[model samples]
Target chain A: MNVAKHMLFPDVGEGIREGTLVKWLVKEGDPVKEDQPIAEVETDKAVVEIPSRDHGTVLKLYGKPGDVILVGKPLMTVGEPGEPMPDAEEAITESNEKKVEVPKKEASAAPERILAPPSVRAAARKAGIDLSKVSGSGPGGRITAEDLEKAKGGALAAPASTHQEKTLSFDYGKGKRVPLTHLRKTISERMSWSWRHVAHVTYIEEVDFGALKELRGRNKPKAEQMGFKLTPLAYMVKAVATTLKQYPRFNASLDEEKAELILHDEINVAVGVDTEEGLIAPVLKNADQKSVFDIAKEIGGLSEKARARKLSLDELRASTFTVTNIGSVGGVLATAVLNPPESAILGVNRMKDRPVVRDGKIVIRPMTYLGLTFDHRVGDGADAARFMKDLVEKLENPAWMEKG
Target chain B: MSRKKVFEAQIEYLQILDEKGNVDASLDPKLDELTLKKMYETMVRSRAMDKKAISLQRQGRCYTYVPTEGQEAAQVGSVMASKKEDWMVPAFRENAAYLAKGVSMRTLFLYWMGHEEGSRFEKDQNCFPVSIPVGSQVGHAVGLAWAAKIQGKRQAAITFFGDGASSEGDFHESANFAGVFQIPCVFICQNNQYAISTPRARQTRSETIAQKAIAYGFEGIQVDGNDVLAMYVATKKALEKGYAGKGPTLIEAITYRIAAHTTSDDPKRYRDEAEVEAWRKKDPIARFQTYLKKNGFWNEAYEKEVQEKAAREVEEAVKKAEGFQANPEDMFKYLYQDLTPDLRQQMQEMKQSLEG
Candidate 1:
């Protein structure tokens, strides 16, 4: 008997739940070869072509190019027409959610043997727990959590079964184990991937505020007259932009397979803004060239738009660099990990005028603290230090634009 | 311990200056001469900064400035009680508290200048940022201080807000957290006579804002915000006790907002000249200056030099601030650490639109 086949789902990059059929490479009734391009599907991140598994005549087309097909599900069926298809139950696995019955138990029963994945066997053995004796709570009495618990303590032997149920309880209980969507799953994998791939080094430093205070002062009135509310955020943007120019490499991220640093030429700075929906980063492209006034106007507009949840998907994607200032409500310095694909992020803290030894005199200066977290793959301790120092220098000098 | 502690916690109120501007023997021992002198300086400096900020606003140099001109003693006294590592969370009106905490005049000026970059404070300074949104900072303080407790930093945080903040949900949230965790936090409510134009009686039915601390399972006290020494003593005690793991403290520092709500608001519209004159009589800086003169601690020469030096410092700060490139883009710059996909597209579209 020959095995029949249907196209199983493919792993499409980006946070796409379902893929849209852009075009079909094969037509219905077309004789398809194994590993052939079946169709192109468009996802949130990119468009990718689906591949067929086995050579067969296309018996049926379940969907068209315009339709979206979920991964791990059947897209089309193919089988030989010369012979009635053998019970190739494996072919319809993507669609089958019920028991595949091998129906009659033999009259002469061989001792019930566990037919399961090897990993489950190993897991049971590791616990010094046997799956042989206990009745499996799985479909068709498959060995599962309940079976494992029964094996742990024979019903006649121990009273520990109640509390011991945690180890043996494999059922979804009365609850459900729903599958994760593409976006949420992507978020999980990325967060974990960052933890695994990047060596997050957080270095915090305190800055004196005397200059910041003076700089803010001389500009506030004029800014207001200019119809912009001069805010500490604008000043921070200035400092970060100046710092980025000095240490351009901090703006670069690593290309995993190429094992090379992709240093972006343009500086597209992203600011994490809190909106009604969630936290979204609205980028300011070419920030280096933009004047503070332009920046302020853009900020006011973007924040309003962000708060209104009117930002398009594109506005959230274009950041080569980013800054999250949690200091709005006066937070002390906070450590943050690298936002994937970006080499570093600067965490801005609340401003406080604390006592400092300025020019060998104990004077009260307004101070801000910052914590920078960068990817070790693209940076070293020295690189981070240099970057931080540059940022600090910019903040310390409000007249930086004058010198520039 | 519970009842007595509760009563003692309520004893932090301060208002009148001592005969010579020194605390009573029982109270003076709580603050030494140096501490007292430092308190006086901070109050005066905060006043000077506020005055400068107001003038800067008038000169069409900076944005709207919140002047803590009449409430200096209240902010300075209570906030200076914090340990360097302890956090001071401030509402927008806590200008004097900001100065007392040591935020530089230049940075404060930058903030008033409406530069977001100016809001970026130094990294190691354990303080929450100045939030323009009223009543939001208190909750942040509770959360931050709770984090400190979890990490065993043993450093508490004190949040500053005006009586207006009492109406915000953050106040209740922070107060609840501080009490529940027994976290070292002090919610310093500067009960300046008004919230913009809303009078105290119209604000809440609670007899005293400090008494509200009892509902949250911590100590609460009413402090005379005008009395610099009392403010200092009470704040110091709260910090010490909080750090010692006693619990959080809610302090209602009763003071007056002699200055306008900001450079934009006209106090004359809501508040009468009689009210202003009455409050002017209790000027925080002048009262302390008078008390300092009465005692041997300060004289006419020291006062003259201090005032002159302060004015010069303010003037120089203004000059430096004005000289700095008024790069306005600092506003849109620092938002998120990294941009999401959509932001890039919008930025591109915006650039093209602007350029085209």
Candidate 2:
């Protein structure tokens, strides 16, 4: 069979100079995909599972387990099955070939040559004591019944913590105390840190959702056809992203060490999704760069992923701001704690038809109370007011969102 | 008949000091003892820093680093020729050049450790951040020189590149622009035999990179890149011509990359160990140290002091770099003067993900 030989080198991680081959996942003549795990390499950073850089059958194994491989040095040769192995000049010759021939696999299935007699073995087996682990004091290191008795109390004893007893206090009423899961722990730590560090200021404003409701009605069918349910939160995300361009300070994080405000350039909005377990926010990346319809579709997909607990790490990271739609749960107004380093969070309350005077006349309008919580260290009250003013305008004039 | 014998250009080779530490007194620039001592110390410090960076990369403390092991004389000598007010434009391999321009070792270590603050130089430093894209900084150097000329500033610009960069369109474009405008710029191509794995022979067919400058209507000279005095003399003369409005000068420093192109590269795959061994004998640091010892400017005690001082400084820099805490938000902060709507959302999304 005609075949082209390609060398496989160690590219385990960036800045890694060399690594020891811990084990080979694929052997000679095994088929491999482009990203299939072929070997495990231990570098200074970590033990990395190296994926194949090409698709072919492994023609030759250049380095065995425990062999040190330099970063650019070839670790294997991959080619078609039954291809002729490269000559001595190209492949790592002589020593490596001899080393490969020396089998390093352990004879794991061989029964242990125990020195105990049949009666002693029977007794030890009955007592559940392993005679192999006991060092016999008898002649030629034979295991006696006495040694077995001593070993029973030593090696195979149960762990200490499993049976430890503790005194209970019944002063308080009986209740079930459950430990926090990983997600809950993360939420507690982050919220506590944010609350302790940030100097928060909450600004509440009433936003007219009449234009957004009309836009949502017009686009709901089209959104459903695209396989997603459209909601007002999508318009809110677009408005926040669009208004962030004008009020960049609100989309900034304060670096306490450097004492500088870091303004982000990409407007990625994290929508808070209420799941059965807890609240999880999945990010819609580059919200301003996307259309309202696209944002709506992503919001639907992300919320589903969040609820299913299948959201990938990339989908949940690098968000510049957050929008919590408390409006769906029927809240008049609610203030959200600032997500640390994010500077602000927008809490959208429920929209309702309320009587208000626009031009000296009583009018029924769909209005919602929007609460903006910001870090006072990063921006002032005026900055927050100006930001909300721009956001409110964009939400009220929702036609502008359709264009871009 | 009109095309007969119109013009003839020749490239001059300059070597003030030999590999054996012998100097041609007539060609010596006669730099003061203090300046000569400082030059040697800078080269030593640059070598120490390069060594430390490579070690750090191997230990997983630093990122992929480009070592300036063999090109110290080329960088330091050229920088010594220019004034502090002159702008310094650099390619990625100019660690020694940055050191000579007063850029702290901590800043350099921080940069290699993947911090953005590493590139933030003080306003008076007049040094640009290390340009990773090969040959791209050539245009910036020319532009800076042009800007200075227009603003009636008395300063010039010195740009450092490699032999690999000479083949880039940016290099040729910058040279043509500088020559046409007679801008105050000095281009130093540290022709250290190999650019990563590609050797000088494969990089170009030209007999010498310096000769390419004649086509653009300017002077070009080749210097023994290992000879510090020769490099300094060539750069000083080029800077003088630039200040006199005589356009730009290209100096080709013939040296060898004694170490691998970078910490990630293995030169044994493409180069002969014998060649590397031979070049190691003509080591720039050794040659300069020899010259200093012969002139009585360097003694055993002084050498010990300089080495210890360099080690201490590099250690301090490493500690500072490791201790630095970079805010994750800094990634988006420097992209623009203010965050765009899209970027603002992106930053928020990142914060949420991390906090969550």
Candidate 3:
């Protein structure tokens, strides 16, 4: 009751535009069922098991896993349990399918074989190994199986000892990466690409902390009592915002069109929070508008939320400026990424005591280092320094916030 | 962790407005008199329409209606500033955008009344059918804007979705495409803090919905959807940049869904009244109304007039929509451009069965 036909791959609901066939279950001349695991196809989401559409003997295996297959391509051939051959032209479509895997099984069983699994068979044929001459190590030892490792100079091979082994190795100079999360994967690619293509210049400086320490000390307790910790972090936050306003150029991004600097009106800042998986930065939308109380409270809140993991989708976006506190982890200085699209990022290191001259007196005071990475495709050093100067001034005087 | 941090991005997370018609503008935009009044009016209209749609659903006059009672400013402001030619794709809860985009009250009601013709709009009205499948239309809007880019058209497409739709793969696909193509598309995610009964805190560990846009390329933004003017200005700038072929913009409108997800859903089951009441104090419409009435742009008389006007218009649409005859065979139509031989035979058989 059956006619000859090859089952082509169908476009399933998963929206896999194209896929790599991972491996095939059947080889030539193998009988298969209608719902047999014919092949494994890998997509962006996951590897999917594709099943056969019809039941029949596998006349041929058209493609192997790791080969890219388009939707609707021929996968396997099927016919009745005991059947006569149909015209090859009509039976197997160029767009139809075929299947089977028979290592060392005689390839002569089907007189109507059109194609092999891979084009590698042609290379093997050129090596002058007569099929009937070699003893087969493959299933059934019928001399039907070819080998990747063969004798070169008339050495007769002995039966191989079997031991299964798998190794995961690494070279000191080499590196391997398994994707952690899709987001981290994306971040790694973008950053590496940016580092490769974008001409990055780093201008880092160590600042005197004498005057700023006094200013923050005066305000810290008051901020703490108000349920806001006036940590050096908050002082830094205000500084970044204040500096952006003074040095508009540092706040500016590349406006490619007018061929000039495009300064933003609002100084929205983002702070990076360390999480178990990786780092996540959420923005404080309009930083310039908030008072010392508001900024401090918001900074503390956003950081805590990121830790406790209460951030909504909105809390993650909207920032014109950003700060990374690598300083908290005791790092003196490290270049930070520009976070892309945004023109600059300010990297902070831990506050440590150092000698500094304040108002003509030399004494040991708490000081930290700053590394500012800018998109020179947009900003200049003068712009960055001007921002730093204003920021330093603000950190030295929190009372200046009321001046506006 | 003692719940130490909150993602308090200025635009998305804040509560300065109180329900008794008071606002602290230090943390928010000070709504001007005229704009404030308009916000309130739109809110009232949206709420009334929501109630009407629920009634219609209860009466079996419509299939389903996703009400937007407390989220008027969110849906309105998300796409309020979009250009006429720009696209407006809705995920069912966007009655505000339908009104804002000028899709005509009659047409929107017609759609709910089960008329396919409801989706047929004037060429100038670039809106798509109300998408039932969550997050799918966002990718469609992205596609349209991308095509606009290929054609060099200075038009952006704005797509709307609820917080729940954010979890779907299509949302990621749409966002990724918009970012990759830098297409003029605005992804307006209304984070009403709930996807059905599930709260916002459960969706994902991502920092923000807007941040998803950054993954693709351009910028992700969170705007106060309840603060109408804030929503208006932010969305405007994003759309302006987008139309100039800058890239796709992701605007997450942070607001509260004051009512149940729909008339069919019971918010009481999943949410407490206390939480709802707290958010009600920050209601966008009331705050805007207070600002407007104080500025002399509106009063009780004007409020009553517009309210009556909107109510009448909606009521008329409902009546007309119900009166329109529905051809029973319309269901079998529009499967393809033209019916195939097999389909024609099936339809012929159906006619005989109906006659017998």
Candidate 4:
């Protein structure tokens, strides 16, 4: 039988919803084996080679290089040798029920789609409010959770009503509208999934980083000689890794279907890096098995790769634990969302001079807040609290980092 | 009114095999060489399967598993003591008991993988699926035993749980009911010290878990859970007593959870490495293997062959489990023989969502 099989673009990495066709490894009429690399597609993480799942001849190619393809959209077609080719328009009409077309004018009117996170969208939906009617106040005019709350409280009642009444008369060319990038779309889906699925309980603790600062100061020259800037994040990763060795639940993932917690033996710490495109976390594999210097070096290299968009799928995935340094990005404190499947994520905040009573004497010390968001379904609150206490103690005395 | 001494319970402790692989002749379970060798090999095979499960979980091929590293003797010996026709109820960590009862390893793997088919077994197998809720299996075992009693069947039911389950109210209720009815049921409590991260000390204030059975008007005995011979002797005696219509018996096996509570747990959180090392020296499989070699029933070559055979069996089981197709809609099928209106709607909705 000369049946044709349409191959869609598979998810190349975790949470990747779309990819750009970088190059077609097989041309039309080329015979290909099952599992052969048929095309190279550029996902948000890296360039991945999409393989053929059927052994046959490539009957038709759907997209050209540099064209964007949605996941589950046909990338190519494989059929028996010399089969009658289906007309492109006929193929399009047959799959038209699945295709969605957004008119240009309608796309510009919904500018809020480019900014708000999933939680905000969900809250807006539940409140029966149109997201386009609510004005965003966050960075890049992104809608915050508070914005949704205010909208629910009728704060935007006037504008919303005005928008409804002016629906027919409103001008479409009043403001510029930008399309959501693949990275932004991916982040939206992933963050929404994480927020919805994980039972997040965030615990925040403050640590005196005086000794750590002094240690970093002493090691700065040696680190400079080694060709990498020494940062507190490196020390934080080390402390988290060490603490996880003691409290393994934090270094675990929850499989809800199986009702099991998957505790990982190796500590792979992911550091969230902000780049020009968006936020990307690159993993530092086997952090527990590495020394502070080695961790710092890998952190430097991985961060560079992240910013340059050169991180491989391997580097961008497989994180048993995550540490986001909001401190470097100038935040005093923030509760992070649990990375999906991972039981916990640690957020490091900015360090500032603070006065505190130690040994009945008031002294100014460098202190920073460590916010740990954990999946309560996998562990108890007491477990998270104890883990935080141990982490604080380890960060307070980073002399352990110098031992190895 | 003058106060009078009402009740006193004397708990007997059994230890046939010591840490040094020395078996007390008086307490020895005098089985033939073939059965002795089989018991030792089963323990080794269980250990091999446990290691394989751990590695497979790490590789993302399986879901989280509770390794039965230090409790093999408690599992294998008790299951071996039960007759083939007797009912066996198991908690989540009773891999040794499952393998010993001739349940295919693939069924176990499929169960852990979250497939409903994994719970399906032949009618005559008489082995229940793994129970996740702590101590709930006790009631089921008691009910099964009571049903057998009512039917005039000679089969006894053996239920396996942990020390953690001893704290649950179900255990108390089941024990009370079993005692009142004088049913043929054996409650095997493998006290592996910690329930997840909580220590056994926190699980209960009582010094001995077996003593709890005395309050229900039944005999309670403690045994060295690391000693296979002791476990066999104690369980055998309890099963015999049950079959003789003497009521139920709670056998508390003193053992340590050498591995984490599960793949998702870290024993180091609430336990000391030195304590784990101390327990390592008293490993049930190691002790049993040493006893086997000392009795001329095993040698290095035979041990190697046993491990190889176990590995091959586990590998084949993994392949079979991986090959099995999982149907999501099958979850609703076994819930009711005739699906209710609500359940039928749910099944339809699930099918729509999956198809979408």
Best by TM-score: 4
After superposition, the stretches of candidate 2 with alpha carbons farther than 4 Å from their true spots are A1-18, A21-404, B1-3
Score residue A12 of candidate 1 by CA lDDT.
40
TM-score of chain A of each: 0.55, 0.58, 0.54, 0.61
What TM-score would every model get versus the actual structure? Answer: 0.45, 0.50, 0.44, 0.54
TM-score, candidate 2, is 0.50
Error of 2 at A329 (Å): 84
In model 3, state the lDDT of residue B41. Answer: 63
Which number leads on lDDT?
2
| Candidate 3 lDDT, A29-57, residue by residue in tens | 78887556777655442344566655678
Please give, for residues A8-67, the per-residue lDDT of candidate 2 as tens digits: 453435634567666799998888875576776655424555666567888877766656
Interface RMSD of each: 31.6, 19.5, 21.2, 12.0
Q: If the candidates were sorted by their TM-score against the true structure, best first, what order would they fall in?
A: 4, 2, 1, 3
Q: What is the TM-score of chain A in candidate 1?
A: 0.55
Give stretches of model 1 more than 4 Å off: A1-404, B1-22, B326-329, B345-356
- Tens digit per residue, CA lDDT, model 1, A1-404: 76555555543432234666656788778998755777766555344455665578876666664465665456667787663543335545644543333324432465667754577677778777666766677745678654665676664366766555353546566774444433345557767788878888877888776776777778778878878787777677767876788776788888989888888887878887875334667888778777776777777777777665445455566577878887887667678766678888888888887888868899887788888888877788898888888778777776864321
Tens-digit lDDT track of model 4 for B80-134: 8889989999989988898878788889888877788888877788999889999
> Model 1 - which docking category?
incorrect
